[model samples]
Target: MINQDFLSRIRRKNNWTQEDMAKIIGVSRPTFIALEKGIGSPTLDQIKKLADKLGCESQDILSEDIVDEEKYREVLLETIRYGAATDGKITKTKLAKLIYLNDFAWYYQHLESMTGAKYRRLKLGPVPNIYFSKVEELINEGVLNLEIKKDGSQMISLSRAGQMLKPNLLKTEEKKLIKNISQKWQGKRTEEIVKFTHEQLPYKICRDGEVIPYELITQQDPEYVY
Candidate 1:
């Protein structure tokens, strides 16, 4: 239970299935599945072995504060709310870039990312692997609607603008940063924002499918940061 989110996230990151994790952790498949679902947990020895195989400390796997899922969910919805076009929809590609900009830009200033999500460089730009699953989860929960346009671009929008919730995990400073970045790109074409992100130092230097390190963003000029 302590690292339920971590177990889920790390397993996904490695492209491992429950059976694979079960074997890696020396547990039965059903037990690992229960651990993933937060129904139970692995023994300390199992956790230690799994941590060793993953080449990380037990604390790294057990630490709940490493990433904030609540903050991530709130940020995703808030980014959708702020960056959507006047028609109240944002192209999925552009939405992802905007969120990446917000995260890295915040890290540039505070030396810590807003949500602590790991972002990798992809064809669209820099984005977290979790972004896609989180958006899909939201859509499944009826909080978001995904529409495919005639051009084949996926558009994301809130089920209702009035459904916005107060963010307990996000700060005023964080909200302001999201708003400012969203404002800068709101009227621009998705191509423009995608190009801007692609041109950023973080994106330019990182190889395809590689995680863009936050430290690299610190080396960028202030003008190109966003």
Candidate 2:
């Protein structure tokens, strides 16, 4: 059975009218309305097309409901562990940019986000707001050990305190994408990564505190032409 509420949310989130969504998904307006109203069902092929057009996973479209919080926490922790393994530790800012790159770059290449974490345009660039709470949860759970020290500035380092996260949690493509992103940013200073992210179209166009839309990744930027 098709998930009408999820479909409706996806369409509205993209700012598409019912007729517009119907046309894009190759359905008549009435058919689309029926689906949205839970009076009709979407065939498997239509579900595939909807996922493709919406830039989401098929399960995301077909699943009975959205439980984003738990999934978000798992992805964020796994990604942090992956990044922390590369270097002794990853700075908070660099980790934030890495997360942003993984999401936006995946969107640029596949029109989908690996974790689908919401990001806000901040002075440091795009920052995933949920990471702070996730980190706290991990610390409480003893999955990570945090070290705070002062040099010229405050410094924080995260080290694994438990066994490595199981590999099965993320899809193969998602694991590969996160690893690729971590390797790409490895050895780069936090400032350099921040500068690079500041150049991305999403970060450039969104005002401070504004939510960066995944759709913005499809836009052509003069600085970084696709």
Instruction: Give the Å shift of residue 157 in candidate 2.
Output: 5.4
Show where candidate 2 strays beyond 4 Å.
Answer: 1-67, 85-87, 152-161, 220-226
Clashes of each: 0, 0
lDDT of 2 at 23: 83
Worst 10 contiguous positions by lDDT, candidate 2: 151-160
TM-score of each: 0.73, 0.64
CA lDDT of each prediction against the hidden true structure = 0.83, 0.68
User: Candidate 2 residues 1-226, lDDT tens each?
Assistant: 3333555656755677998888877899988898887786777787788788868877766642232455555556555666653446767777777777776777677765655567888998887767777767777887766666564422334445544666555677777878777776677778888898788888789899988887888784633521
- Scored by lDDT, model 2 comes in at 0.68
**Per-residue alpha-carbon lDDT of candidate 1 for residues 1-226, written as tens digits (9 for 90 to 100):** 4534556666755778889999998988888888887787678888898889979888777752345666788998888888888989999999999888898999899887787788888998888877888888889888999899898999999986425666777799999999999988898999999899888888899899988887899999999888
The Cα RMSD in angstroms, rounded to one decimal, for candidate 2 relative to the true structure is 9.8
